[model samples]
Target: MTLYSRVRPLAFKLPAETAHDLGKRTLRAAQSTRPTRAALSYAYGYDHPALEVDLFGETFPNPVGVAAGFDKNAEMTHALAALGFGFVEIGTVTPYPQEGNDRPRLFRLREDRGMINRMGFNGQGMERVKERLEEDGTPGVPLGVNVGKMNSSTADEAIEDYRRVFDRLSPFADYVVVNVSCPNTPEEFDESSPEHLERIFETLAAENDADVPILVKIGPDSPEESILELVDIVRELGVDGIVATNTSTTREGLESPEREEWGGLSGKPIADRSTAVIRAIAEHTDGELPIVGVGGVDSAESAYEKIRAGASLVQLYTGFIYGGPSTAKRINRGLAALLQRDGFSSVEDAVGADLELE
Candidate 1:
């Protein structure tokens, strides 16, 4: 059995958030020295020509990435890259730091291979993240910044919040994701409404002097029609791409005792739904817009399925937690085999391969 498989039982004994913090600290230590970083790369990193993908004017070494919230404060990007992820997205970073929800806010749905969290955008804020990036330099692969407003910010204040974070951090981002879809945050205002989204996109677009590619993150529970409406708005404002999707609020088919926890649901249970959303967006946009598919991706087959359904790239957080440090290397290696088996030359060729047929 794998080392993580053996240790997971012990890790699960701790509160989910505590375990996560400890894991990040270990990774941070690992990346502190070149020898350890090199050792990590030698042991876990994998590459294949067929796994390369070009998206948002950047070449991803592979399409497998660590999703946001995993490195919410930008603490472990270099370590994650050493673990073989093609890219790392840091933050659902807000304009200011917030304590977020109460303790015991993160739960492990072990039986269902999922997790529920009401983290509420807890992080060291944009300025700290920017300073971290500036001091450490970007990781070897692409870096994405997922920006969000403070939980207490009103609708009008929210626009400024997003703009401020974007202005400070976009320089370091290969792409920027405007995260209006996080279900764990306060709902004092309709952040996902068409008018609010329009204001956000317009304001960010105006401030985007560097022309960093901007995308939006959507939730899994939104109706298909509403999703399409948001997609339409993104296209109207000339946004760069879409990250489909955020976690689900539904607990329809969960087996774990923690399934009923109050917050966003992520991991295995939401995989199919996320892929369906990707397919819908792909089919609607006629494969013209880029998509970074996320939600419940834990294996190569699952990641490949999203690509076939139209994801230019895919990200995973809970999967990384469960699969351990070798997750990306294993997934990327398996993807190459899957590509050849399916007669696809590369990951780009596989994207949207099933959309037209469906």
Candidate 2:
């Protein structure tokens, strides 16, 4: 069995957040030097020509990326890259550091192969993340910065919060994601309302002198009509792309006892719904707008479904936790085989293949 598979049982014994911190520490150690990083690259990294994807004016070595929450403080981007992820998105970072929700906020739904978290955007903030990026340098692959406002910020204050973080971190980001759909955060205001979103996009767009591509993260629980309206707003604002989903609030078919936990649901249970959202957005945009599909992505089949539904790229967090260090290599290899099997030359060619058929 794989090393992580062997150790996972022990890891699971710890609180989910604690285990995550331990894992991140291990990854940080693994990336401490050039030789160790090279060793990791030799052992885990995999590449194939067919896996390349061009999105948002950047060339992703492959379409599989580590979603934001995983490297919240930008602590392990190089390590994750060595583990075979094509790109790594860090943060949900705010303008200043903040302690999030109380402890025991993250849980693993073992039986369902899913996770629930109410992290509330706990992060080291933008300055620390930017400093780390400057110190360690960006990873080999593309880097995305997911920016968010402080949990306590009001609707008006939220705009400045986003702009401040974006202004600080965008230089280090290949693209930036404005996260407005996190279910774990305070709901004092309609963060996803078109007016709020417009204000956010306008504020950030003005600060984006570098013209860094700006994308928005949306949650899965929203109705298709509402999602489409948000998509239209994004398009009108000249936003760069969309991360198709964040996490689900509904616990529809979960079997794990942790299902009762109050947090955003992710992984297997949300797979079909996430794909449906991707398909809906793809159809609505007629494949014109770029989409970075996320939610419940754990295997090549799951990632491929999003691609065919019109995702230019895909990201995973819980998948990496369960599937272990080699998740990206395994998925990317499987994707290349699937691409050849389907007669597609590359991932770009395969995007929206099924959407056209519909």
CA RMSD of each candidate after superposition? 1.0, 1.0
List clashing residue pairs in candidate 1: none
lDDT of 2 by residue, 1-358 (tens): 8998899999999999999999999999999899999999998999898898887778899999999899999999999999999999999899999899999899999999999999999998888998999999979899999999999898888998998998889999999998988999989899888888889888987888888999989889988999999899889989889997898999987899999999999998898999999999999989988999999899999999999999999999999999999899899999999999999999999999999643
Candidate 1 lDDT over 1-358, as tens digits, reads 8888898889888999999999999999999999999999999999898998988888999999989999988998999999999999999999898899988899989889999999888899988888899988989999999999999899999999999999999999999999989998889899888899899989998998888999999998989999999899878988889999999999988999998789999999999999999999999999989999999999999999999999999999989878888899889999999999999999999999998743
Task: Give the alpha-carbon lDDT of every model.
Answer: 0.92, 0.92
lDDT of 2: 0.92
On a 0 to 1 TM-score scale, where does candidate 2 land against the true structure? 0.98
Worst 10 residues of 1 by lDDT: 349-358
RMSD of 2: 1.0
Task: State every prediction's TM-score relative to the real structure.
Answer: 0.98, 0.98
Any idea what lDDT model 1 has? 0.92
